[model samples]
Target: MIELNPLVELIIMNFAVGLIVTISLNIEVGYLRIPQFGRLLAVIVGAVIAAAVPGRILALYLGLPYGAEYADHMYNAKIVIQINNFLSKNLLLSLAVFILTLVLAALAGGVIGYLCAYPALRLKGSYLGITLLTFGEIVTSIAWNYQPLVGGTAGVYMVNPFAFVGSGSSSLAALITLTIAISIYIYAEILARSPFVRMLKAIRDSEVASEVYGKNIVKARAQTLVIGGAIAAVAGALWATYTGRMNVASYTRLTWTFWPWAFMMLGGVGNNLGILVGVLLFTLARTAIIQYKYVITSVIPIAAEWLEYILVGLVIIFVVMFKPQGLMPEKPTLTLPRKAIEEIRKRVEQEQGRL
Candidate 1:
């Protein structure tokens, strides 16, 4: 068996997380046309849950209190050690807790999505986008200042679910993340081929027409946001498990929001295949920039951190200017059978003739 380098493993994990996030974004902005600029909202909810919930569960199982006192450095270290020791002795329980965290995270995200839609129902275009974005910022601010929430600025170290795997924890985490990413991609592809996706596209293309055809536009948008938000939260849960830590700073607007949007736009809006391609390209670029930052900075006048922003901005600008539809322009969605479609077309023509 070949041993993989730690850095390579980390890169693979990042790519998997990125893939999950970008695909969820695609479903909202690409297919449903929700323009969910507050992508970090769902993600942060997941991370916060992961940071707090699992630890509380473990503390309860061990008959200990769950709070900042328990989450402090010395206390947290001891708790993690005890948890790992218990997990090592109880494999099934460990797996169960891990699964439970994911479920809770997804549920929380879905509920938040539904609530967000109420404010969004009365807004459209840039107004809707700004509202969502502001909501995310407000949540982040609360998380950062409120000590009860993930220890506030101090953040909290999470108990790794894969601790039982011992030395292979990193590899196991990468494997799990990759597996989830692939599963979601397949699921999204299946959804893309379904009639439901066509409804979402219809909503995106023409809300008035879809309404005329008796479709509940608001309901459709809400459903899409709920589903997308749930999936995106799964990414955050995975990230928390992978890193074994949670911080508000880590789930930033740039990392969780703008970057995934960039991936969605670059890959080709509404194109799943394009999303995959865009994720790969951007992930690779990001990994390379991070890995070679010091070397690159030595030759360039600007700082390494700013260089990444500059390059990403340039890519977005170039893509928008030259290929606005993205690398793979969205294809027409054909949900109805040929016969049914023809009948509908004939009926439409007859109605037009009367007019």
Candidate 2:
């Protein structure tokens, strides 16, 4: 049986992580309306950053309560081994390395997504998604095979994220992480409900009509992709920190990007509140499944472990059959007022004239 405090701690932590991941994906599928397939690239980027930053210094800089947490991990033989495997015990260089890794990976991931937008110019929907998916697979494969990019199939052992940095162990990190998740969701919420988001909806609904009405479809998409991709990358950096390991196999299909898509789709694309609900439910259900794995294993006799696949497939089917528009479909978009339209035109002309 799981301890009450730890169980509560797990729920809080998973919920925080799930919300961040879901919101990042929402930015692509809902807000940007881009056919994004490699959003997981962003998750991986965040994970690496979070892991690489020396925990102790990071905890101080980020105001994490680190004292008790560090001692707990230090005393644990397994955790100590993980720490030694991934980081130099000396704090300064490790922290520097962490910062460097986070920035480089994020920028690289963003640049890759931005460049891919060019190919997207010639494709949309499933096709564009497939193309990005191919890239993601290739990257994941390389990571799995390469020794330095993180350990190979063995899966790099990671110290608790920023264990040295913060003071309160898992709960403290969970609280901080949840706070960041809430803030990001709030920002995403503002974007989702703003005139800016409605504009994306207009394009998604009918690009030709939007173009005829003087909306720059290209500019809107490019802006959304860049911002969404960058934010996703940040999320990835955070994940890396929290987990402290980066095996390519862990990022394979459905785990990083697709899982979030599942939540967003199940919840309803373009509906922020629905996405939040979906994430909570999904995390709880998955956690339950894990806790009862032994029961599941004994109850159902199978040649292999296909539970995860079955669960995912059932979810996809369930969403399709019962709620094609998702559990909470996005509300119909409304037209912007004529005055607002005129103001936009005026602003554009002034900016163009200045340029």
Number of the top candidate by lDDT? Answer: 1
The list of candidate 2 runs beyond 4 A from truth reads: 1-4, 49-109, 151-161, 164-167, 302-305, 333-355
Give the per-residue lDDT of model 1 (tens digit) for 1-355: 2335888887789889999999989988988778789999999988888878888888887987676666565577677777777886777888888889899999988988888889778988899999999988999999888876677777788877777777788688788789989999999999998888988888878889989999998888788889888998899999988887777788799989999988888989999889889988988888888888889988986678887898789888988999998888888865579899999999999999999
TM-score of each: 0.91, 0.74
Residue pairs with backbone atoms closer than 3 Å in model 1 (clashes): none
State the local distance difference test value for candidate 1: 0.85
Q: Deviation in angstroms for 258 in model 1?
A: 0.4
Local error of candidate 1 at residue 263 (angstroms): 0.7
For model 1 the local lDDT of residue 223 reads 88
Q: Give per-residue CA lDDT, model 2, range 129-240, as digits (tens).
A: 8887877777667656654434455554454534444445456555666777798789988887788888888788888998999998877776676666667766666555
- Reference-based lDDT, residue 89, model 2: 49
